[model samples]
Target: MNSYMKHGFAVAALSAACNAAFAADDITVIKIGSAAPTTGAIANLGKENENGARLAVEDVNRRGLVINGKKIKLELDAVDDQADPRQGTQVAQRLVDDGVVAVVGHLNSGVSIAASRIYHDAQILQISPDSTNPKFTQQGFNTTYRLVATDAQQSPVLAHYALETLKAKKVAIVDDSTAYGQGLADQFSSAVKSGGATVVAREATNDKTIDFKGVITKIKGQSPDVIFYGGMDATAGPFIKQVAQLGLNAKVLGGDGTCSDEVIALAGPAVDRLVCSIAGLPLSRMKAGPAFEKEYQQRFGMPVQIYAPYAYDAVMVIVDAMKKSGSTDHAKILAAASATDYQGLTGQIQFDDKGDVRSPRLTLYGYKDGKKTLLTTMTP
Candidate 1:
């Protein structure tokens, strides 16, 4: 009895160990890259973008994602580009070398544009949640996609608001000289002129320029009714603060980058006179935005920044493409992604021919009582 019992127990333990090993090997892991500037002035926003992708990976794994009858686990390969174009290209090559099936990042438009060539050459799908410049998608690369409206669509809406709602006959334009900022400013300038408003002054500043006294001084003399700033909140906040300190009595308008809670923190009470626009609907207005916000805050212990929801949706879209294509092949996923019609946290996402979201919505925001308040939502 002792010999038989010992043999039976050994065989059972061996079988159990083999089964466990097989089960472990049965689950396939897929790596997706998330690139953003996590160490720079706009790091808060970049971290938010990466966190969104990380959360999506976590959620998909939690739900037991299976593709092609294989249990799948997703890995997020997050990188920091520091919002630099050269760094972005380097990160792109690194992501390609790392064998990521797709990427979601390079929040700056210039960075996205610079990195798209690498992704394109490697046949990796790249989805940018925050890059608003039109050139990112118009490069004739099938690998590029985005989740929000473009600057071409966003700038005009801001311009229309300035001309019709704010009744500004004279507008001043300032840009941070990056692709996103300068491109947005150029578009806004054209729209403003077309809307019958005079562009009193146009100025340029680098993204890191904190001292806007000289630019603001020049704009102040113009006595414009509204000053449009095309840049991120890091500079927008200080620019507005200096505008007030200089006793400029004009309203400050900005694009999606300037439409953030960070601006309120950076500009203080000067944010009261600032108006901004987001490329997508406000969190309260999104179909699943409230739930996404709650989950994001719980997971990260921080409130949702502007692009978190979009980044989350971008990852989901990539996974959705994998499922629909029934394969993880980059080409198959890219084909499927081009035809995505999923309802995401932001809204229904379907890419147009240029790999841009179709029929995107824009929201105008103003600060009330030290918080961002939605002024209006428009479709352009």
Candidate 2:
């Protein structure tokens, strides 16, 4: 090559390298943590939550995030808590140490409650998409927020439905003994008594108990009009299947945890007997749910489980806070989050004094033709 041509090529390469370096230096990276049980029986649900957060991050970057006149890049640091309390705390600490300014996860109420203190101590904003237990927000942690209604609001609705709609004169209650399950059962029990329904039996089983023949056998003897199982689909599926196998002809009721597609997969034909309530509006009812659902399916190659839309909204809320605050400072962003009033894919996003969604909606679902069909949506 000629010397002039070589010189020109060298200048062009140097200019391109400089521009690349400048572009890299101009962007600020912000890390957001997403924690859930990505392994074990409920991994599908956890993965759904994580995928929501990931999609939000991608969307934000695509739209060109800018804060304080500086370009910002968002990153998702997802961790697995295995739906265990101890692991949840460990994951919380890791996220804090990893320099995440905010988190949008820990799907289980037990896990969210267990890890809440760590996030509070670190002053990192923690927005849970599906933790429905009241204590999670009642702990008086300013840094903690949730995207769904609590069991306090949801159980009474289910109770009323059981008493008025289903006309259950006698009810049997079973819980998986996790905070989410037990809390929901306790609330439902109180509501049932208040609604003048006779509580025929109450049973306690841990979340990992798959073989519920003993419990089913005991429940079968009660001849209850309805059986309410407060737990996730993993156990609820088998429990309901066993209940049917043991010839317990009562209708099955469940909380949001059991109101998943996984339950339909696990329980098979028995799922038809299940009438479950979710702590939020059905996807068909959300303002932007249809578009989000379409995009989610295209991006993730799977349907939305219970909490993906909420998780997506949680991440967007965090980003909205960052934008409103005009800085990435954790304290500033948190302050902004406390005043959030954004329109999310789920619904109008606003937090009550206890960090719970204000005027939250609950959805009742029943299976029809082996598919989850919405019965009704109510505000409680």
Candidate 3:
């Protein structure tokens, strides 16, 4: 062969080699969906949670989470459920239809409770960062998982504070009529009564209500020292404003769902001394919090919300489970998720037999100057 012919052959060989290398690193995409209220009133909570999940997915893909001795990119498939239970079920079905291997959320407890059945029947894995209702894993689905503590652990703590620390003798319960709201409300009522306080009154409200005036007026007349609301920032926010405007002196308390700066903004100065319980340590307090918050703020140009860290941890949990399972088979990955012993950003995460977070941290907070002030943590 002439010199030119030899050079042409060498070039062809290098090109072939490059093509083979590219083919070896060929991508495999597994769509992982998260269902949350991406619009409507609770969108801030859902957007924050979904943003955390999105960051985790991006990080894993950028850093190359190894799976089966190959770098695999994580894909997030986020869907909107608008915090409605029926919408949650639809979102779950849509994920299944779209062939999502796993899912990360349904922010509302009722939504999680409703959509979990769909995931269970399909044998797809799901991990919730915020849903607290115990009924989620009680059904023996084996497909449900959580990063946040259950209402069982959370509600009793709230009740103890109201009766023991605050010395509230008479208390009333109010719920949004959600699986989460009712469950936490029931637990709080029982715990306060067991702690030697009177359960003066109990009431329920639909999530769509703007004016809680009647309920506020009735509870005020009941002469309760405090009223515990088991619901989200949407109704809870306005409830606090209306209750304060109704001239009630009793302080309002709520669960993780009701802990938000929006609640404070809605209540304005009325938010002073408004107390609530939320799982895990707060963002400004976590050891991993500052870095996470800095990066998240830089990327999204917004402050990190309460549940985002937990949602970020949820993605890491799923990614680690996929690595440990040796395959992305739904059943195997789901099994591995249940077996995770992770030191997440919030804290150590270890699931109980019921797939609920075990001995997770809790922080009681009150709103001050349009921000959340961590009063104390019930450290175990």
Candidate 4:
């Protein structure tokens, strides 16, 4: 059979297995699907997301959650989608086939966009830590939940900072050609346009291409005052390196994807003007930031990445919803999540009309001298 047919069958079979089947048994095995890039290109990010989720699972089980007179033990079934959408869809189907109660994964919005439908049909709740596409929850999928702020919330904030704060007019845009990358690029472009700044050029590159000399050359030709990259740090780092070698005189404006230590390490000194907007982690500027950052460092023995806190919060949000619902039944979980109003390590986690987080704080960062410094923040 063709791949599409196979995908359809898997989704169908999965829906039949898990959709609202255990509506009566609220204390059934809480199977939680966790899909991320455990292998292949983006393994580093995948592992961090996994770590956050695992930590929460441990905490939940330790608390000995009592539901329906039975102790609830969360069973986290992890899978490696390798940051690929096809693999993510398959993993979602497998989890539904296994009758998982919920899920917390698909680190990229690209993967989540493809997998959410399968979970929706199966009535299996999914709480994503990193997927930021507004469409994921806006598709009328009650099962879809996310802890990260969407590009719709961060893009315009970044654009306003670029023109008002950074004082840049001519800006260029680039994306990785994936769902998350292109969608973020579009939002950022719209924001830039609204800010009265012109995007001199827009370009796209696939996940495979490592060399960005061609794109850099084109960017240099336009000589934009600033450049906005709506993709992750994986390729953005190397792209910055090449852009530096060619001496492109433009301030770098990137989204949350570039707000990682990995990007700083790869881009090095060339990232002096690196400006980015991210779903504000409470570990940096908040009164709780220093404590959480310190604890995370002590436990993990390393600086926390962008998504760790978000992932940790995603797990907490799901667990909180389960507690509030007083049951792990799929429908109960949905109702509980819809009424969530809790403060997370990321901030006060609340959903809006589209089921996306509302009033999320977007923080901007800049690389000045030899350190990444906070530039500003605002609501989007």
Query: Each prediction's Cα lDDT score?
Result: 0.93, 0.93, 0.86, 0.80
Model 1 score (lDDT): 0.93
**Candidate 2 clashes between residue pairs 3 or more apart in a chain or in different chains:** none
| Model 1 lDDT per residue over 1-380, tens place | 69999999999999999999999999988999999999989999999999999999999999999999999999999999999999999999999999899999889999999999999998899999989999999999999999999999999998988988889999999999999999999999999999899999999999999999998999889999999999999999999999999999999999999988899999999899998999988889987888888998899999997989889999999999999999888788888999899988888999999999998999999998788888989888
Query: TM-score for every candidate vs. truth?
Result: 0.96, 0.99, 0.93, 0.88
Better of 3 and 4 by lDDT: 3
Please give, for residues 1-380, the per-residue lDDT of candidate 4 as tens digits: 99999999999988877765654365546877788988876677888788778767776787777775766888778888889999999988998898777788888888998998998888777888888877888898888888767888888777887788878788898889988888888998998898888889999998766799998898899989888887777787877877888998777778787777778778878877678777765366666667766766777787777777777777788888778888878768877888899887777889875677777777778787657787766666
Report the Cα lDDT for residue 289, model 3. Answer: 95
Cα-based RMSD of the predictions, in order? 1.8, 0.8, 3.1, 11.6
Please estimate how well model 4 matches the true structure, expressed as its whole-model Cα lDDT.
0.80
Of 3 and 4, the candidate ahead on TM-score is 3
Off by over 4 Å in 4: 1-29, 286-288
Off by over 4 Å in 3: 1-25
By TM-score, the candidates rank as: 2, 1, 3, 4
lDDT of 1 at 19: 100
Off by over 4 Å in 1: 1-16
Model 2 residue 17 CA deviation (Å) reads 0.9
